[model samples]
Target: MARNPERRTALVDAAIEVLADEGARGLTFRAVDARAGVPVGTSSNYFANRDDLFMQAAARITVRMTPDPAKVEEAMRPTPSRELVADLMRWLVQRMEDDRTGYLAMLELRLEATRRPALRNRLTQPVRANFDESARFHQEAGLPGDADAFLVLYLAMTGLLLEHFTLPGVLIGPENDLQAEATLNRLVGTVVTRVIPPS
Candidate 1:
């Protein structure tokens, strides 16, 4: 395979866009090359086969979706409380809005995985590790609630994002974005107990 790191990364990123736009069946070396503006057959040089391309695209999206380190630092600076937890959740929502394509690509990969056992095996560990790390982080950060809280919020927000991106009108109609913000806050509140203000 081609070994130029920068070029490889670009090819993978381009492949992600193709996967998001065209789904697994639509992903091809030519499509990726066109999307990346590279010469035809460039993607094939970087990737061994379609499976290689799919794995690389999945890895790229994982990096893209990871939480911002500076933002994590800022969140840690605050006293760990329910409000801070809510803020973190809001940050995730904001990220989805900003990187909608990456998330869509991830969703596409998930669908494709259902049909490809090798891809399924490749993805299972990272997805579980992310969840495990998230639970550990919540505990270490002294955030309100436990691993269960994080799990619930994670699943709820995943469902919300799926609906918001795939079928916007279903869950939060008309003013979708605005409703998503409010709905996220409510979800956090329900999962993590609210802080009572001093009278």
Candidate 2:
């Protein structure tokens, strides 16, 4: 809505911060203005509504959370082996810890999508595209396992990440060790070995 790119970027970035710190319910134009330390109606000028802000924030999350492609290419080029997948999972887990608030807000955005039809539809397309793109990457790289395998790994690791980071002790109990890398190794290895096709 706003043509001023710098101001718009500032508002969107501020919206992301608000979403992360305050959750969706707490993300108001006023809240965003205060968080951005701008004028009282700065966010209102940039975004049409809260859902518009939500969409922009969600889009920003994808960009912020994705691993660097150069690093990924370097990592995966050596081999499309299970070890590569494990390394990727490790990267994801490390990112989750490093950007704790960002991932937490992502989870919040996901929940919000479920209740709102427009939001759900808006979010679902990108989610599917990400899945498809990952599948293609794994398949094209001649990785062990089919396209669906990556999808399953995504689901599995998502669950692990959610519980491990958000609920902490709920996942790390008696027999579990404190190292997330170990858990990611196990999860990725299992998917490649036992779950996904080797051919």
Candidate 3:
């Protein structure tokens, strides 16, 4: 029997939902099949193994967690570089706040990839691409073309977003918008100091 692409996609989507709702430890072929409303053998036919299903689910979640670069570029096209960074920072915070489940699932997958070489290779390209884009954007914005500094800024921004989401009430005040704006301003100022030398 031929495989159904629609069913395969449905299974992958179901796997993502299962991971998000129940965490990576709760994922199973049976669970995915049930969530997908397909026969028990259906997920097995498509995925062949747990690792296969997990990689697909992780890819789907990763895609959902980040904004499309094209759309981001278009939205910031008319904005100044500093303003664009601030907007991107705001967007990152919003994504963290809106999709905590998806982010958690991604983190779970990342941890698993540490022990699974195949999964690590599968994720390496996308991870590298994200870092590369950050570096290129900083360079284009007249920052020093230091890859290390760009990576530090990227990691710092991501860390802040994660911390805010995982511990929302701790760092953020009653006025979250104001707090986020202040945080972004400070982050951008630090990046500027590191990326630019005194004139």
Candidate 4:
């Protein structure tokens, strides 16, 4: 009935933590309120229902996980497009590694969406928007790749981030950050350097 942006944000963030820690099944208004350290019913005051809370949290996680624009611009300067793409991929992998829990929670939400048509429909828009925005950014940066190439890169990178962060030590090979970055670079290079066919 009233505006409480900060409280709503807090509730959504708490919901994310609970979703990540306890999976989608454990996400309730009560759990969110507890995680937010707010009084009982606080989460309900903000979110009308569990689905609302989850969808909001999913959007917030993407917002929090997006690359910083200033840094992206900085990386763009004095670097070739291929090299810049590698830099961008490195940044993306680092973000997932740093916020493993949030990403895990996002994955949980994605799985939950499959069973709920309404939620899946809501999520579809933002998912497409992400790809659209990425394609726009690549074009603006004068990158060699097209939206199609970036789409392929997105799919590959999503798998890489999901596996690398979700199950540490499962990837095998060297476990250090440099080695991981190198691997990401090669993967990114492969995508960015590929020749796109006429549309």
Off by over 4 Å in 2: 174-193, 196-199
Score each candidate by Cα lDDT. 0.81, 0.76, 0.71, 0.77
On lDDT, who's better, 2 or 3?
Answer: 2
Residue-by-residue lDDT tens digits, candidate 1, 86-123: 66776787798888888899999999999999999888
> In model 1, which runs have C-alpha deviations exceeding 4 angstroms?
176-199
On TM-score, who's better, 1 or 3?
Answer: 1
Alpha carbon RMSD to native, model 3: 3.7
Error of 1 at 158 (Å): 1.3
Ten contiguous residues with the weakest lDDT in model 3: 190-199
Q: Give per-model TM-scores.
A: 0.90, 0.86, 0.76, 0.85
Tens-place lDDT per residue, model 4, 77-184, is: 864466667667777777787887788888998899999888788778887888888889878877767676777778877776776767645553565778866766
Give the better candidate number (2 or 4) by TM-score: 2
Q: C-alpha displacement of 146 in model 4, angstroms?
A: 3.2
Q: On a 0 to 1 TM-score scale, where does candidate 3 land against the true structure?
A: 0.76
Question: Model 2, poorest ten-residue lDDT window?
Answer: 172-181
Model 1 lowest lDDT segment of ten? 190-199
User: In model 3, what lDDT does residue 82 have?
Assistant: 49
